[model samples]
Target: MGNFATLQPGGRPLVRFYLAFMLWFVGRAIQAAALVDPNVRKEFNDLPDDFSFSLGAAFNGPQMAIGKDSNGKVKYLGKNSNIVPQVKITIKSMEALFLLFTFRESTPVANSRERMTVEGNLSHACACVRILDIVQVYLLPKPIAKLAIKRYPKWSLKKHTINRLLINLRAIIGF
Candidate 1:
């Protein structure tokens, strides 16, 4: 019957395990803190109003499909066919910031005309502008809006252009 102190090997492993666990825990805490810092949130919120974002480097492919008949028959429509795709972009404004994203082809269209028409209609629709991470889109707080205007004196600050700004910001930030 040896005393526990005499069992040196077991105590060393336990101490090492505790130290490793503490190091891992500390590393995770630091990472989380960096992500949720108030300054980071504020910086994101304060991004330039003209910022825009795109899905990828290349231009998005044209979305197309075959025409459908009233009888639910598959119509083999050729390119520039009756069927076309729709894309929608939505921007929501949070406190001193704007968040923008896109929803595509949410609506069904019978032909290219309908698709083009819908797109045209949406072009004028204020909601269709695609700025991402806007602190405030509509009725922005006077100061914040003013700050944005000051940042981009020449730009229209429209949704489309704003989205482009956001896309660029995302790229610059590497986020």
Candidate 2:
């Protein structure tokens, strides 16, 4: 329906499309959570204004943009472009990335296993992992989240319901 990674008759584009989709999927989940979850949003708020981060893989591999919008909200900067991010997180391979998203692996575990690498401040990297962990709780259901994260928050029913509703709305509305 759109050039939003519309399929092309090539293997490379196909892989790129898949990676882009995954990045968008995961990014939205994290961004939406950051908007509604005070702790997660606070992490971004504490960063320098316009702090930028990029995630990608090896040579000529798919890359995704993530940055603070003018309002200091964490948002996806979309497909890879010229924006130079202060931090870059690169995975060893698509398979490794897939494992992380699929909940077969966690970020710290992946780092220890040498599946991913980061070039930037260690504290920022840790913060990113924390945000991603919260995203996992919202994005993946209980069964998967339990497997992916070392600790899942035990939210009260009332708080959980309202947070879920707001997170989904903000995600769709692109706040």
Specify the highest-lDDT model's number: 2
Q: Score every model by TM-score.
A: 0.18, 0.82
Q: Candidate 2: where are CA atoms >4 Å away? A: 1-16
Give candidate 2's error at residue 22 in angstroms: 2.1
Report the alpha-carbon TM-score of model 1 versus the true structure. 0.18
lDDT of 2 by residue, 2-34 (tens): 656855543466666777777777677677887
* Candidate 1: C-alpha lDDT: 0.27
- Worst lDDT window (10 residues) for model 1? 92-101
Instruction: Give candidate 2's error at residue 24 in angstroms.
Output: 0.3
* Top of the candidates by TM-score: 2
- The TM-score of predicted model 2 comes to 0.82
